[model samples]
Target: MSNETTTADGGVRKKGKLGQRIAYACGNLGQAAFYNAMSTYFIVYVTGCLFSGVDKALAAKLIGVITSLVVIIRIAEIFIDPLLGNLIDNTNTKWGRFRPWQFFGGLISAVLLAVIFSGMFGLVNVNTTLFIVLFVITFVVLDVFYSLRDISYWGMIPALSSDSHERSTYTALGSFTGSIGYNGITVVVIPIVSYFTWTLTGAKGEGQAGWTSFGIIVGLLGILTAWTVAFGTKESTNALRAKAQKNGNPLEAFKALFQNDQLLWVALSYLLYAIANVATTGVLLFLFKFVLDNQAAYSMTGVIALVSGLIMAPLYPILNKRIPRRVLYIVGMTSMIVAYILLGLFSTNMTVVFIALVLFYIPGTLIQMTAILSLTDSIEYGQLKNGKRNEAVTLSVRPMLDKIGGALSNGITGFIAVAAGMTGNATAADMTPSNIHTFEICAFYVPLILIVLSLLVFMFKVKIDEKMHAKIVKELEAKLASGEIVDDEAQTAETVEAIDEEAKTLTE
Candidate 1:
């Protein structure tokens, strides 16, 4: 779908260029690569290896405390996401609000990614209390920068194009690249952490130093990709923001968020999906290390995720044309549940496990891609209903839900590890058969349940289908052409001219 803008010359212009799609999609690869490494492996590093060989009791306690902190920090983002969104909305600069934040956020997040993994600044060597403080501080800072980049980055989607097809195309590209960057590391990280050893210290591959070295490489790569996005994609100001700003109620920004029905439903559904998705990824390390007794299988599972996304990404726009997003959501959720059940039944068989994962992730790709597209469309829904576009605040819902879900999943992983005596120097050999089963339950069943619950929220609440979206875009375009949507500054200038003309006539 061409994002048609009614030009001053009464002509329509297309906004989504091929180059812009490639550039914007490239950023996802960088950002996801950096973030995925941390979200999936950071907790494993801390609980599984960082405090290894300490007193079993002390190590367990430390894992508990640090895990708690991770949860708290993520929960805190519920407040932080919106505030950052509001800030992003209010910001004005020559570079554009989104790019400036995207560039700086990506840069800072890249540096912090290395720092977080490096365990530098005395974080790894410090006592439990001090480590928690440092960890929380670093995590929060990284999250803030991440939010700056994420909110601005995805927020730009609505600005990129208003057409549903165009939005989904960009979204699919982003999802495709992001899944690769995000899940692709799962294929390599474990192998690197498990088998590849650095020459400097000859430490084990999964050891602290090895993970730190890995982080540095990933962080630099993220910086490069992020820069690709910053320089490559151009954001158009001719979006919902024009009319939304005219109707913007700064003081009511927070309240306005809840009032947007499309945003609300999409956000709520994403919250559940994110929790399930994050938890499942969190459990992969344990699942590979403990139940499967081979860390290399992580790569295989990661391959499943990556391949499924690859297969589905290109198919999304095609599939979406045929199926309603709601139906797709249901099918995806149901497929995921069935796959998980099959995975649990065939837990010991690697071949079956791989097959089940392949099935699970195909729909998983659909779920992820559509969620992003849905959120992008919600910006128009908000603008149409509220008379103001809160793109940043609205887009912030993803990270907000993501962080919340990640926190829950991470917290659960930590608690499960502590309870099963898997924390602090615990290896696959140390776990009993029952402990392996517990890992499976966390890895598969919990997420299965969450997906089902989210499906409920999606079916009942999210009402903006493709047809409705098309109608919204058409109406908005008509308004723009008819001059109902006016720029605030331009309106002010026109008002000033009218007053001046009247004054001149009276004086004459």
Candidate 2:
């Protein structure tokens, strides 16, 4: 028999196990790997591949166009993500709502990951117009499965735990595991395979053999990672809320989603952070090549340091106990400020740049993990305020921001890099060139400035902390149990905490 039942508020209520949460976080390794590889290295890979076989200027333009197209496709995903979320909400599988979506999304993502760099559609011989057409189609198709899976993956975060501390721990776990493994593999290890293939194929070209092989390897890994997550994830029945039988039209649902305020702020913060992140990640090639003067070490050196920041993520719950989420956001933004300033001012010595990268990413990484946890908190906030659990709707914010940020960043960054006059082989020795100079400025200066500004935005913000969250979750559970309007506001904060702590004891 079907297990889902409707709560008075029309939202699904369920709890997942600790083991499932751990599996879910591990499964997220693929997501992190794909994102890190694509955002940081994809443009560089394409540039190298094209330069080996084609003109340098033309190759730059080709990379720019392809990057811009990927961004465009990403922007389109804002619309697709919510639709995918609703479908998962409505779905019923013996395997559960989320796992099936995860399975299909993984399979599709793996196939396309390899296809994007397959050389099945040779780039060297294709005319500019033809190149644009084929590349756009392939990249857009890649985004489709990507957004679907992305929406489903993050949407499940809240399902893992209702307790504020547990949820923060889960988010931190995902961040920590993903940061170490993803960066380690993508940076330290990826080039080994790429370089090896380059030797084997005797494809003396820049990255034709390397990237094509790289894409295949990353894709196969993604498939395996995704499969593990799908098989292991336990989709507990939503002890509350009935599943929808009718399929949703994507546009109508977006209109409905647009009206959600908690969702709106989460979406906004995500969009801004994404813009900052994409620009930072996208500029690495230019920095190592032109600013650091080491083309070979460009990929790993500064980036590897960001892993230090991930270490701070698991400290979130403890910090949240002492500080509000908004304050934590400010802290993150402040750390970013110091990091960015160091890069902008003292990015000279290898040691200075390495320290700078560590400082910058640590706070940046905190904000990265915090944003989702805060948003998950808001999903509870959203439910209390709006009377609908619509967990998937709130989760859609990640993708919506992703698409907007990716599109704007990708397109704008491409054009910006070109206008700045950055070229393919821009080693530090090449820094005297004007575009390379602009590339350096945009890379360090822009992110630094944005960090200070982001801090300013949260100065007056109100956010729930550990105590406040306990009260909130307790009130929701009491109402769900009693089926009566207990003067929710009549209960003092102390009273609410007492009730919540009591209820949790019962649950345990």
Against the hidden reference, what TM-scores do the models get?
Answer: 0.89, 0.84
Q: Model 1, stretches more than 4 Å misplaced?
A: 1-15, 194-196, 246-251, 479-508
lDDT of 1: 0.75
- Cα lDDT listed for each candidate: 0.75, 0.63
For candidate 2, the per-residue lDDT at 429 reads 60
Give the top-scoring candidate (TM-score): 1
Per-residue accuracy of model 2 over 1-508 as CA lDDT, tens digit each: 5433433334333344566667787766777777666665565565545444677667776777677667666766666777777777667778866777778888887778776665545654656677677767777777777766777787777665566666677777777767765565546544654575668676443556666677777777777777777987875543222222332455545654664454555556656667776677666656666666765776564356445645576677677778766667777777767777777776556777777776666765667766777677766554444345656666777766756755655665566556655555444564565665566577767766665555554443334445555655666665656653232223345644554454345333
lDDT of 2: 0.63
